[model samples]
Target chain A: MVLDPPLPRPMIGRLVVIGLGLIGSSILRAADARRLAEVSVAYDAEPAVRARVAELGIADEVASSPAEAVKDADIIVLCVPVGAMGAVAQAIAPHVKPGAIVSDVGSVKGAVLNALRTHLPSGVHVVPAHPVAGTEYSGPDAGFATLFKNRWCIVTPPEGADAEAVQAVTALWTALGANVETMTAEHHDLVLAITSHVPHLIAYNIVGTAADLEKVTSSEVIKYSAGGFRDFTRIAASDPTMWRDVFLNNREAVIEVLGRFTEDLIALQRAIRWEQGETLFDLFTRTRAIRRSIIEIGQETAAPDFGRERG
Target chain B: MVLDPPLPRPMIGRLVVIGLGLIGSSILRAADARRLAEVSVAYDAEPAVRARVAELGIADEVASSPAEAVKDADIIVLCVPVGAMGAVAQAIAPHVKPGAIVSDVGSVKGAVLNALRTHLPSGVHVVPAHPVAGTEYSGPDAGFATLFKNRWCIVTPPEGADAEAVQAVTALWTALGANVETMTAEHHDLVLAITSHVPHLIAYNIVGTAADLEKVTSSEVIKYSAGGFRDFTRIAASDPTMWRDVFLNNREAVIEVLGRFTEDLIALQRAIRWEQGETLFDLFTRTRAIRRSIIEIGQETAAPDFGRERG
Candidate 1:
């Protein structure tokens, strides 16, 4: 049996990518690889990023502004921070072509959906999405065509959203090498709060602690990081503004999960202080099973030591 | 110049290893691969582990007891947990010949040193070391010869120890593919408390929290772990018994560091609650440099996401 080579651009009409950071740049590069659109244009507020995008030829055209980028586009993916969503929608609304499907790759879906609904033109089909894929690295140079391959892209189309628009957005993400699923913005925010936001918060807090220690020098932490602290640093090193926005926008969910995390931590602290070996053992043993489940579900590698050997 | 393929066990002495778990079995396999010892013997509390070691030909002989394994050996390595150090030392004291170097690979040095000094016979050079390398897996089946390659081994020799014995112990680890450095037992504990013990405690605590959540399902935690939580689960999945022993044996140091960690975490929590975006950004940006230094020092790869790919 034989299969035809996937076309570069599976979707028709213009695809305007706003913001040329890691996610936005990757989207353009991937679509260009397969010629996924009849026309591709991108805009980044940062002139340096815009110039770099022009240099890389990542998109068919680099627009001078968001308004210009989506002038005749069938889809406009606002890959800006959650805080920037409303402003970006406002900037592009006047120029967004009627019947265009508007989406985003923000982490906080509920807040982003609110912003899109508030500022995007009534005719624009609002389809807020969260692509749960990224590296700590950011910027145009940090992105690659395969960044979204095998990653999950959750599309949250509010009630009464255009079904055709939602389908078009899902199909676009699928073609970009992602697995797409639909859920409400509220559920997406809650799920991500526990899965991503709080974990990142914990990592950031710990790394900060390690750095600010008085007796234990920072040099010592870096030298012996292979012990465990190094892994936390990777997540903690993620884009600061982006994460800050996530925590602020999803405050209720983040606070709720963080409260649970604090309670569990206090109990473990008590166990350690009181020498309750059995309690620690039970908890540790249970957590090990979670790691196996993650590996089995294809979210992580089963390789020992995270397969961290130089490759 | 040719290096003679680094003789499989270049040291001229019989190596007796007690406890055949991840670290123990790795030591045996590495020594055998390089011929770093003349003849190697090992003993484990578990008969199944002993049988497997013999089956794999990991050592010259699998002894029935620690006393028997160290009877005629010039060097005896205690690879058991920190809590088991004292009893194992007592068992081998009468059998360990004078001038024989007694060493251990426990993570907590101060406690292990105290155990060695009290239980082992006089004139037996005592060396307590930690090869800051391991995977989540344990047991003989999880061992590998290259486990210590490019890893750091902290050799904490007691004050006024035999120079010759210390040199022999250092040579053994260096030949087995670890970079060896010497420090006092007290200092090693303090450093490891921050670098390893507390980090593991946090990982275990977070995984436990995520699992015990009422609102967030365990299944969701596993499915979406790639966002950030998966890395913590990796560290948390480490052998529970080994970590429990570490925390107990290094109680003072662990408590001290854990205290600082709690304080810092509380401050971050406050900042988050108050919407102090600058505070969060400052911490997130600073942590990124630590990751860079770890990668630059060769302890970790600069690869995005710890180089965790489909493999």
Candidate 2:
């Protein structure tokens, strides 16, 4: 019955997951499977999602309220959208254990850091984290136990964050199958602004443009999307509330990066207009090298066609 | 083989594929495997690709040159890059079989149509086709027989073209597992500009922007690419020569579409700058609907996470 060796459980005695969408439910599933905590509790604003999590038996307890869920928890992970982080943290702050490590899974850490500093209780330690992985799908059903496998989780701890709390949170992510790296909140926001936020804005804009084109019907766009356009649709399909908050909260970094991207795109437009083949060729070649490196190291290049090929 | 049911072969005596790249070799493999043609012949400008196609036995014969490849071929396809299409047609024109049907797998049809009309010899029917399917990978070894399965192939026959040639080409695509539709060359270019060309440009431009960020190193960009940026890199990694030619040949349409996309992007960028959450949210939600439609009809939504799950 017990053929495999027992895994070393992390020191988190009670792990509370607030907001039961993709990231929240995934954390619960991973913590349960990996035995990262002694017991797990969950709370989602949506009753339907709470019911689904209960039906799936993803957590040991499905709480009626965030306060009830984190009443005795040693670690509380806020899993709500970035816009809801401040309120969620404020609501659960009063119930958290005196030395509880409060953390969040927000894409933009600088804003979350400010939110945590403003809303969370003084005694509860705040260590903001961002797991740089997702699918277009959302809700509890979209979560899987291994979603974090081989993914990066950047922990953006404040300058005066508790060292023990930060280390413990890092161990928890490691136990849940993520590689953790520590950085400042400002640096994290700048890096993510370039990597995730602006790219998402561009994708959302293109899909919007394609849909609104009078000359090309939306059906035609859908039919022929397999050629390059569909690739953007995947990321564009990410939860709107989450992205909306990301842009609002990380306004400065996003605007800064968006400005740069706009400049590059305009230059490209000029080259295309003037039939500058060599310029286009050079950029395409350089970008191809970047993808090659991403594929080789990140292993994102495993399946050709991004695995869209059904046959 | 003896126990298997005999397959009904599609018409056409010889299908000659010029340029053994992803689409070219894929056609040869699909044709040979489906018995769509009695025999398939191929030639590539690159000697190594020719040798590999011959060694892989993907084609019945691998000729030394495009001219040799199309001699007596019933269907001759110029599969070279779009910029090279005119020259490829001119090179193979002298040896083309009398009354033979010539076609292509270019992304932009109007330019290809013009190239065909100008360079192809008389008595050789030119029916430019764009099979709206591909993986990011290029080269002979990257092709598979099932690449065209369930994909769409747009056949843009010129005015007053031979009816039998169009029907035979449609049948060939159907046999190789594609849904065929016919449209004018002008309409094809416009639709493809929105669907494929502009999207490729955005992908290329963003990847370049990410790489050139002075604050975030390239390694960081690649490592954290799973956050929306990785999707762009997949399309950006496509063949440089092919994409450069696509931009050059389809410059006016592409520039026109890019102007619209840039306008939309700047609007979104302004929304972000001014903290227009509702505008961003509405656009993001609408785009999600577009992706759902693409998933429903195109059936490209298989395997969540765009098949980037590392389990």
User: Could you give candidate 1's per-residue lDDT for residues A28-108 as a string of tens digits?
Assistant: 988887678988999999999999999999888899987778888998899988889999998888888789889999999
- In model 1, which runs have C-alpha deviations exceeding 4 angstroms? A1-4, B1-4
List all candidate RMSDs to the true structure.
2.4, 2.4
Query: Candidate 1, residues B1-311: lDDT per residue as tens digits?
Result: 11125573357578899989999999998888778787899899999989999999999999998778888888888999888999999988988888889899999999899999998878788988899889889999898888888888999988898888889888888887888988888988888888888889888888888787776788877767777888899899898888888987888888888888888877877787898888888888888888888888888887888878731
Off by over 4 Å in 2: A1-10, B1-10
Interface RMSD of each: 3.0, 3.0
Clashing pairs in 2: none
Worst 10 residues of 2 chain A by lDDT: A1-10
Model 2 lDDT tens row, B186-222: 8888899999999999999999999988999888898
Highest DockQ among the candidates is held by which one?
2
* Candidate 2 C-alpha lDDT tens digits along A1-311: 11112267556789999999989999998888777778899999999999999999999999999878999898989999999998988888778878989998999888888888898878989999999888888899998877787889999989888999999889888877888988888888899998899989889999999988898898888899888898888889999999999999999998888888889989998888888889999999999898889878863865787765454
Q: Please count the clashing residue pairs in each candidate, in the order shown.
A: 17, 0
lDDT of prediction 1: 0.85
TM-score of every candidate relative to the true structure:
0.96, 0.96
Superposition error at A57 for model 2 (Å): 1.3
